[model samples]
Target: MVSGIPWLTVLWATPTVGAALVILLPAAQRVLAKWFALAVSLAVLAITAVLAVGFDPGGEQFQFVESHRWIPSFGTGYILGVDGIALAIVVLTAVLVPLLIIAGWNDADGQTGLRGRSVQTYLALTLAVEGMVIMSLVSLDILLFYVFFEAMLIPMYFLIGGFGGANRSKAAVKFLLYNLFGGLIMLAAVVGLYVVTAGSDAFDAGTFDFRAIVAAVASGEFVVNPAVMHLLFLGFMFAFAVKAPLWPFHRWLPDAAVEATPASAVLMMAVMDKVGTFGMLRYCLQLFPDSSLYFQPLVVTLAVIGIVYGAILAIGQTDVMRLIAYTSISHFGFIILGIFVMTSQGQSGSTLYMVNHGLSTAALFLIAGFLVSRRGTRLINAYGGVQKVAPVMAGTFLVAGLATLSLPGLAPFISEFLVLIGTFTRFPVLAVFASTALVLSAIYILWMYQRMMTGPVTDGNDRIRDLLPRELVVVAPLIALLLVLGVYPKPALDVINPAVDHTLTTIDQPDPVPRLAEGPTP
Candidate 1:
């Protein structure tokens, strides 16, 4: 009833239906497959835009909700809805996918591997992954969310292994194994959560509905031993942290990023990786607020380490893709820090950062793909003075690089600033430490740009062409969004802040008072 339009169903079903259509297409009709995939993605994007217009930012409850019984005995249902947070991410997913389809239109065509099935296979898997991602974002039932969360890996696995670099198989296996292990651990927590919910007085026995669980927890009808609860919390937290691919747990990302095609990397870094951080906000804090507070120090410490370590590693990278991957680790560190700080500004900033990072990172990956396709290499020193031969590509790459560094007039700067300010209000010393990443971020981005785009034109670079019309089409929207979001972020903030406030209310936590500086002798 929130939107009275069954918007969530349409959003999820569009991609699923599209994927089925792509699979049914004639095997030889690769062109038809690409067009059909793009059309499907565009349809989803249009639906998401409509949903955004109808969304009531002031409302604190889930909107566009649809629920039907799927397993009555287990108290689970086919439920879907979106709060402000989910709404933003769902839209981001919708937007990026069409662009990804356009960017990869010819990437898999005539590729030697895969027995010439790369085009149809790539399109089908992409649509399938889109459906799974949207489902994960909107699912209101814990069981349903878990299903979508785990199922997402299947298509991504194929995308990485089937259509990537020489080492694609190895990267795909590493990615699957890491996520599979995380999912298995979370399965234990899911079962334990179900048991705990069944015992709660506030819920029907065997309920797997997230809202029901939240109600039980809030009302104190669901109780467990503190030690048991901490274990449950850790189980969920570990899965999310690994997904967030937080430090120490982040080893697989560089390999996967280096091996994946540019479009696939966008899906991994910009969309799929977001699932982890989003899970932390949705599951960890909401379901286990006490444990969240208990472990705040530990999580914050890891975040600080990720910020510094990721930036340092990025600076040392020789491969362009690997460097971009390392930068995301640093950016994600800020996101985790903001979430654990538990301030309104921090949470909102973190959410906004998710959207901003997706755009900026997509630009970087896609533009870098253009460069690699031209020079046929991913090494930083492969070619130089590229700006001389390909001015447009150089400009686009520089803008993306600047955006990654969160330049003052770019989209990410606002969110990064908010995270630091919010963190300072709660943990001044930690804020000071986290802020050091800012300088490190600048060094890595500028260093990469200088090495890759500056200096005299190298031998192979002389033949490199500027971005074609199709390539321009691929990156223009993202660049435009970065500029628009940078200047006028209020619309997004308005939608995000209320949802963050509602989340805090659910956990009965208030924003900490900012520590004010005192005047001398006042």
Candidate 2:
């Protein structure tokens, strides 16, 4: 049943209104714009909390739907709804938005060359991106989904191109070119899906409804030969892959993450990239189950390669932020690995990983940003004895870093364990290779930690202060989550499991693949 609360609309409006407020704030009230953005993000978080509580795990359908006829002649409607999978992603976005603003605190382009005049524009763009991401997460219709999916690229492109590091424009262009190419291919497929269903009328059917298409295809009412179906699936895969960016497709991620503002990097890696894995779970797996199953090995191979490749690269990085970026690539590998493994534990773990990874990555980037802000560089060798000079900062980094390595009590540990356990049942050899990444992760994380936080004080680092109250506020919740979820993940998992089960059911898969209790041997 559709939720009566108009929750999705509320979600969209909160950020939309916030963005408007940011734009309209008086020039002298630059501080007001930042507060307004934070307030809006907080409001969105409240709604997400409500969603988490109110969402019916057992409903077996999308909830909080808000549908309207946007274009009658085309059979298209402004349809929005959230199922289990989308719910998790939505909550992830809501959770990250506030943290993003916290990270963006007092951050204007002035240091990067932005005069105060541009602050409102930056905040507004951030809010706009939040709205688009929420829309994309809840959109139930194919065309609407595509619109929001592609729309997100805009605000983010500006955030990077305008406010990013020295190579900002180049990074933005690379991001756009890669995504546009994939999006165009997906667009053709979307059109093809429409044509495949139009049935000789040769006229536009005007409907791009996801359920309608799924039902029609499944019931054999709208037949596309298996070959054509596979082709269409590839289009969707290409778009999502470039976004999830498995292996060779990931060239944009490191550069983009490095060049973008720290907050932008967090949003892109923590929230946006998850959309790719998300699309695979919801649309790719649900809309084309056979293709997903058939292509599992090939996709898994890419994921495994990314896992090792990203970890290996991260180990070699001296740039702090770049190292973090590569870490994300490695983590995405784990997410996709569980997804294609096709076990309930794997799928659920992948979904949970998205949420936890977002929290951890956001924390790390924000803290790194603080360090760079104080020190004027992210180079690992720029300063030594940081822990001596800035114990609070080092402590925050330690917590966030431990979380990244999947320390026993943190959120990532559970999810990574789930993925490995789940995937081992389906793909043992690949699981073995993927498992080795954990060791590599330890090497890079600890080695970097030692290099940056354990040495004697240097003259360049003498002025470094520990985290201030505002910076601590930015990190506190993330630290709390690390302990909370690590100790008892049930609250999040309760909601996540049902949604995951729903997606699995939609794709017609059975729960939790069985295997020997023995874990993979490295």
RMSD of each: 1.5, 3.4
Instruction: Estimate candidate 1's alpha-carbon lDDT, on a 0 to 1 scale.
Output: 0.90
Candidate number with greatest TM-score = 1
Please report the TM-score between candidate 1 and the true structure. 0.98
TM-scores for all predictions:
0.98, 0.94
- lDDT of each prediction vs. the true structure? 0.90, 0.85
**How far is 292's C-alpha from truth in model 2 (Å)?**
1.1
lDDT of 2: 0.85
- Give candidate 1's error at residue 316 in angstroms: 0.5
Off by over 4 Å in 2: 1-4, 109-116, 200-206, 218-222, 511-522
